[model samples]
Target: MLRAHTVEDVRRAEAAAMADLPDGALMQRAAAGLAAAVVDLLDGAYGRRVVLLVGPGDNGGDALWAGARLAGRGARVEALLLADRVHAGGLAALRAAGGLATRDPDDLSAAPDLLVDGIVGIGGRPGLRPEAAAALARFPAVPVVAVDVPSGVDVDTGRLDGPHVRADLTVTFGTHKVAHLVDPAATASGALHLVDLGLDPDELGPPALEALQPDDVRALLPRPGPDAQKYTRGVVGVRAGSGTYPGAALLAVSGAGCGLVGMVRYLGPEHIADTVRTAHPEVVGAGRVQAWVVGPGGGDDAGSMLAEARADGVPVVVDADALRHVDAPMPGCVLTPHAGELAAMTGVERAEIEADPLHHAREAARRWDCVVLLKGHHTLVADPAGRVRVTTTGVPWLATAGAGDVLAGLVGALLAAGLEPYDAASVGSWVHGAAATEASAGGPLTAGGVAVQIPRLVRATLNPSGSRPLE
Candidate 1:
């Protein structure tokens, strides 16, 4: 899994490394890596015009040192020192390498092929300074390579507070930051490249969220043995849809019907149940279930079934309409709530939850004592213990109606197949997102199409060469 730690975790990791090594060794290593990437971008560094927007701290030092390396390779480099004070050693090294440092902002009209933004790093707050903002406005056409992080982005929170630099490429030091995984800021970071600083992963504190790599999800997937039967694997009971909306039930069942799941049970209106049975004859009515997916379109009727499932000690995935029925904490339950449902659960306005989803999702997880999966641009899955995983692979086209029902059912399938609530939710989200990508293919996709695409996507994730790409 690709893990993204918070800025505090990164700072601690950096501090630990700095204490073990020489004073300037970390900075040198970071600069060397940055320089190499910049050179690669230049193809050959003979007479390439490189511009560095320098700031006051170690971030500026990194830029200056990288500029020196480029100068040594015969690249004509210029540094625009925005701050009054700069890194003494790095600045002197750049000067010795035949690089010129100036304080004027107007001279930035010499738009180079690439701009290295050293204006702010992970430690700085979001939004640009007066001088830095003005200078960047001059070169709208130049492709930017952000050092450490794109300036004016919340490094720790991944939320964009204001105007931020949209980088074509960002070379970050040590580990991936929260901004690299979370939305808004993650979207601003065009293409990310990490420079290994040899920081110990175990030494770092808990990460904000983790992205499930193919191998990670593959390892978590359930495999049936030779003697495995339909009843032996696990039974998932899905209580969703009503007379008004039968398609929600159909879509959820489609997501859950992947061969990974042994059996699907229906408990709702007869017509909707008939629709599910018509589409997939394998499903049966509610029997003893290993896990339950309660919600989708069954508005008020969801409460009783959700309560029954919660009382049975079976792991339940509470979603959509059933979100209101989440009365008390269930130890092994998973709650999937979009912003509006999350607001209802947390007793806050939908706007407030939308503003800062990470904070509110964690709050709900803790309060409900269950795994909370908040659906949005960057789908966040948080456990009651505060561990979180963020899924970053969906597009705007996946926002169609009944999309969430498909996701909830997918998670239910995972839960029935014997994954923990957290792992099941995370893995299910990964599959849901991947399926959406395959279904969309850059154009609009219906919710049904997304659900239909899950089985192939799941197979591809499990065995890379075993499945066909969605056409």
Candidate 2:
């Protein structure tokens, strides 16, 4: 799992580590790591031109010291001091290493190979200073390597309120900040490289957010035991689609039949059910099921489907048209809502939800008393208890229609297989996103293509020996 800590947590850990270490030790370690990362980007330090955007605090100090190291290695380094009061010791070291320092932006005449953004670390607010903005505007094409975080992002909330440096590479120390994992800000943070400062894991407290890796998903995925039978594995029921949208029924059943569930039962309008049967011959009429997936293109009957699914007293995955009918939390229910659907549930604007997804998703989870899966570029699964798992896999091609229908059925199958609401939602989302990437293969894909790819993706994860790259 990729854990993202808040700024306060990082500050507390840094303070504790600094209290025991000698003077300047932490900064030196950070500087060394930052310099090494920049060296790797440049490939060879000698004769390369590097520019440092230095600010007032320790962030700027890190850049200055790193600039000093680059200068020592025969790189031409220039420091553009953006603040009136800079780190005096760091400036002296840079000067000692033959790095030029200037307060004027015009001193930077030619484009450098790389720009180091050390202005406004995790401590600063969302927007950039006028000087910083001007300096950034001067070099439109220069690739930036941000120290700790890209300057001016909301380090705690992952919100981007104003202009911030968009980094090509971010070399963060200690641990990942919330901005590194959460979107909007995460999109600005190009590629992340963590440099360990040896902070104790206990000191960092709990993570603000987490992204499940492949191994984490593998551990959570349902696997049959030696004595397991078809019935024991689990059965998932689908109550989705209507005669008006029979394709939704077929897509949902396709996802449920991905082998996550031993059986898939479909209950819907007669015409849609017939269509589902023809497309997925393995699907049967409604019967006993361990869990239910309700409401994708369910039309006017969505309310009845939700109520019936809730009456079963098993976990349910509520999605699409059923979202508005959800007045209170259902026991063991997972609510999947896109920005617009979430807006309708919470009475907030869709734009606002998209702007700050983490806050809105958590609020909805608490309000509805269930696991809320807010779909987006980075899908978020928030439990009522406040824990969150972000889905970091997927391509832009996944924005096509019918994707959510497939995801709802897949999650319901996992829930039937006995994974908790949180795990089922998180793992289902991870696999859904990964399957989209596999089906796309750098091109376009339909909802059916994505659904068909899920079993292959699951099989590869379940048996690594038979795995090959998806094309």
Candidate 3:
């Protein structure tokens, strides 16, 4: 699992760790790791030209010390002091190590091979200073390496309000910030590299955000027992599709009956149901089910279907048109909505919801007292209790039509398989994304193509070495 800590949590943990160590030891550790990463990027620092945008804080100190290390290794390192008061000790060390430092903007005439952004750390607010932005404009095409979190990004919320450093790589110490995992800021953070400072895990408390990795998803997967039967395993019901969109029903059933659930129960118009039965002969007419997925392309009849599904008293995966009917608290249901649907449901602008998805998702989950699965580039599943899990396994090709319907059905299948609302939504999203990636192979794919890849992906995930299972 990839865990992301808040800025306050990071600060608290840093203080606790610093108390146990020497004064300059912590900065030295960060500097050594930063320098080593720069060297690897340069493929040997000899005769390389490196420039550091020095600020007034510890971020600048880290850059200065790392610059000193590069200077010692035959790199022509120069520090551009952007602040009136820089780290005195770090500046002195840089000068002793043969690195040149100048407060004059004219000294920045020669653009270096790489730029180090240490203008603002996690403590600073969102925008960059005029001089800092000007310095960056001087070298428009240079690859940048940010010290910790990208300068000028909201370290806690992952929102970008103004000018922020767009880095090719960000070397974070201790642990990841919310900005590194969440979007907007995450997009600015080109690639992430962690430098282990070995802080106490106990002091960090619980993470604000958690991302499920392959191993974590594998552990959470539901495997059938030896005596598992059709009824014993699980049954997922789909109340999606209409005369207008029969493909929605087929796609939803395809996802639910992808060998993850034992049986599928499809309840829709007789015509659409016939189509579903024809495509998936194993699916049966609705009778009893462990879970129900409602409203994919359901038009005006969505409310009635949702009401019937809710009457069954089973966990429900609400999507598309059904979101508008969600006026009351469902308690244990999963509400799947894209930005536009979510905006309509909450009466907030779609732009606002997309800008700070973490906050909006959490608020919606809390208000509805259920799981809010907000689908996007990085899918987020937030529970009423405020815990969130980010799904980061899909490619851009997964944005095609009917992909969300497939995801909704998969979530219902997981729910029927007895995973809690939170786990069901998050795990289903992870699997759906992985399946899309496998199906696409860096090319275009339809929603049905994605559903067909689930079983193979699951088998591969469970048996990464492709060895025979103990059947």
**Model 1: per-residue Cα lDDT over 1-471, one tens digit each:** 788887788888888999999999999999999999988877977788888999998999999999999999998888999899999998999999998889986665476877899998888998998889888887889989999999999887777777788998899998888888776677788888899998977768667778887788889988777889998888898888977777878878877777777899988888788888999999999688889988888777888868877777899988888888878887798999989988887789998787677788888899989999999888999999888899977888999999999998889988998999999999999888988999999999998898889887877787687755454
List the candidates ranked by TM-score, beginning with the highest: 3, 2, 1
Query: Which lDDT values do the candidates have, in the order given?
Result: 0.86, 0.91, 0.92
Instruction: Tell me the tens digit of each residue's lDDT in model 3 across 387-428.
Output: 999888899999999999999999999999889999999999
Across residues 416-449, which tens digit of lDDT does each residue of candidate 2 receive? 9989999999999999999999999999999999
Q: Give the TM-score comparing model 2 with the true structure, all chains together.
A: 0.97
What does the lDDT come to for candidate 3?
A: 0.92
RMSD of each: 2.8, 2.2, 1.3
**Model 3 weakest 10-residue run by lDDT:** 103-112
Error of 2 at 193 (Å): 0.8
lDDT of 3 at 226: 90
TM-score of each: 0.93, 0.97, 0.97
